[model samples]
Target: MSFRMIAQERPGNPWFSWDYVQGNSDTILAALREHAALTAQAVLIATVVAIPLAVLAYWVRPLTGPILALSGALYTIPSLALFAFIAPYLGTGTSTVLVGLVVYALLLIIRNTLAGLNQVPPEVRDAARGMGYGRLAQLLRIELPLALPGILTGVRLATVSTVALTTVGVLVGHGGLGQLILGGFRNNFFRAEIMTGTLLCVLLALVLDLLLAGAERLLTPWSRRRAEAG
Candidate 1:
């Protein structure tokens, strides 16, 4: 049976319909793939950039204010405006969306990284120094490990936020599931398409959060042990 036939039979719009899912499985999956890819790319790039910036800020007192201020300023820009502004230079599509998502992610990740590093007790640094661990070694072995929980928490938050904001990329033709959502509204309020996109986005966020939580547990076994003991 055709989609038109199915729609004619239904007459009234329903929130969901197996016919829609069956008819548009390929398109839906493609959009899902695009959304997931864009989100992952944005977050990964943000993490890479944020870590270095966070580390620099932590070590350089003067840079702390500027780095944080810049990130905060970027965060304040509305998603739609930011994408629109970048579209002229970037020429729309995935790059514009990717850049905007990365900008949005930076503040959260940077702040969390700073918080994590600061929470590392002074005595731990002293002990590492006493053990002849150099600045880099101390950071890698002691400070970063201790700071993992806070850092991972920030990543989890940033990732979830990115997933939601990714929908906004539809304005530039790269909104992943957002495309479906917009399409639904444009095509006479097709509830099935809208619901599928919305539900999948929520599902993606939850799944990513759970995966990150598992990673945090794996990486910070000592924290888990302490919690268990407590």
Candidate 2:
């Protein structure tokens, strides 16, 4: 059958009519919302879990080697296998997707968070101590502030990676922009729908990266001011 004939409105299947177009658009919107929600949830959970572990590892020194090794191993699990392994417990949906994403994000965020924290100059820490700043005070007022830019940079990277991986959820029956690409493939429609999904994902990543970059600059106004001065 011709493309038009195949895509054209049929009597009983609701996908063809103008009403269906509007509804499908709504469905896509809902899917996008779900995708964002799951991705964010995973990232936030992973960030909370990983950053502290990273901080502790950095502080402990003895545990650093083991922790890094563990994270690296987790990172090696192929996305598809990770999702499939979780399928029995989490089943097919956002939960499994979130779990896989959280695992994937841990190594990245933790490493970045550690690097950002460690980047604070030792002299600065000594100065803070000399000025009677306690550990908590030093971390809150000095170290974390200095680290914020790099932490935000890691977040931007994590978000973009999650967005791309969410597309893979289609394989395990989760829906998102991936559904668009899957539908296109199943229908043998070359690249039209696939391209649409790909472009949307890329654009979403770019926008997220820009927003995170802005947040970094906003949070580090002193750096920006110093740059202006120089």
Candidate 3:
């Protein structure tokens, strides 16, 4: 029922046992690898799909309502139910997890993308047009670069969220840190496994978030300059 060992004279109770961890390095490490891969894969797919939807939502007035509404609705779906619904069609496994994670990310990515684009000063677009830039040229040259911070912000959030949700994805046979947590629960809350999975999940999210933020800072030198000045 428990993975902890309590010595009669040592302590009243132990939260987790390091000795158990020593024997389970393979399982823990393997789950960590799978968890990282699953999270990264989901984020990449979501970004690819969300970018165009975000652009459409920004440029096309009529489609904005439907686009945002669709993404928002999808975001509201229970992750487990969505995974279950798609597993039958996707036939389970990684494909099903990918579809579910991508759909869940859409609302965040699309909304942030639109906000980023909208934040671009109207004068900047006007000036680009004044300089003989076409709509596409304006978007490519003036808007997208400026909007990187916001788009990347969404990407950061979606990536971290995907990591957390991957634990749920274990239901349909997608292995990750979540699988470890599920295993712990099945084994009457095995403390070492549960703690390892939980800590690894947090560690992974923090590392990924910092990496994204670092990338954003590198790409947006102007923001860094502003920070330095103020």
Please report the candidate that would top TM-score against the real structure: 1
**Ranking 1 against 2 by lDDT, winner:** 1
Candidate 2 vs 3: which has more lDDT: 3
- Candidate 1, residues 1-230: lDDT per residue as tens digits? 57666555666788888899889999999999999999899999999999889989988989999999999999999999999899999997799999999999999999999999999999989999999999889888898888888889889999999999999999998899999999997886688899999999999999999999999989899998999999
Over the stretch 1-230, how does candidate 2's per-residue lDDT look in tens digits? 67656555433433224543465677566667766787778788988898788778877899888998999999999999999899898878678888888998888888888889989999999999999999878888988888877677777788889888887888677757787768766864534555555666678778877888888888889989998999
**Candidate 3 local lDDT, residue 185:** 63
Off by over 4 Å in 2: 1-23
Worst 10 residues of 1 by lDDT: 1-10
TM-score per candidate, chains pooled:
0.94, 0.86, 0.91
Question: What is each predicted model's overall lDDT from 0 to 1?
Answer: 0.92, 0.78, 0.84
TM-score of 3: 0.91
lDDT of candidate model 2 versus the reference: 0.78
Extract clashing residue pairs from model 2: none
TM-score (C-alpha, index-matched) for candidate 2: 0.86
Off by over 4 Å in 3: 1-14
